[model samples]
Target: MKILTLHGINLNMFGKRDPKQYGTATLAQIDDQLRALGQELGAEVECFQTNFEGEMAERIHRAHTDGTDAVIINAGAWTHYSYGLRDALAILKCPIIEVHMSNIHAREAFRHVSVIAEIARGQIAGFGVDSYLLGLRAAVSAVQQG
Candidate 1:
């Protein structure tokens, strides 16, 4: 199965943004780990990240054309209010999983709402990098079961 893992907005600055929250892992490091985990789970993983909302939406559209079997997205701040991204994800036929390194619910009130949650098959948060890993495992399992 092919799983597209998307990181959004300021996520590229993960390691430098806030050590208290995102930990010290760079975006590359996180993707590399997810790829390794994906291999063990028998799924091919492709990762993408962009600060631009339009570009993120475009990538989601491309994933549809590319025949991606599942998607795991951590849309950063966009997770709270980007209806456009949510719409793009809604277009996908495969399972969509939303993940976050920090617990949005435990943060500021603005961070508590997720526009993507309505369309996603599941949401995993507050477990740091493990959230992404779990999201990947969930996507793979969903595809295999389907």
Candidate 2:
């Protein structure tokens, strides 16, 4: 299976952004781990990180044409808003798992609402970097089941 992982907004600053919430792993380190896990699972995982909303949306739109089987997206602050991202996700024909490093529901009042969650097959949060791994695993399983 081919999976596309999208990391959004301030996420590029990961480890340095908030060690207490996002953990100590840098974005690159996390991507490497995900890539290795994907290989172990016999799946092709492609990752993209952008601090721009439009770029992230374009990437999602491109996934349909890139032969991606599923997508795992952590839209950072965009999760609470950005209907455009939500719409882009809604257009994808594959399964999408929304992920977050911190549990939004337990964070700021604003973080509790995720626009993407309305269109995603599921949402994974509060597990730190494991959220992405779990999302990837779920994406692979969803594709296999279909």
Which numbered prediction scores highest in lDDT against the true structure? Answer: 1
lDDT of 2 by residue, 21-133 (tens): 99999999989989999999889999999998899989998997889999999999989989999998898999999999999999999999998888899999999999999
Candidate 2 accuracy as TM-score: 0.98
* lDDT score of residue 53 within candidate 1: 94
Cα lDDT computed for each candidate against the true fold: 0.95, 0.92
RMSD of 2: 0.6
**Clash count (model 2, backbone only):** 0
Clashing pairs in 2: none
Model 2 regions more than 4 Å off: none
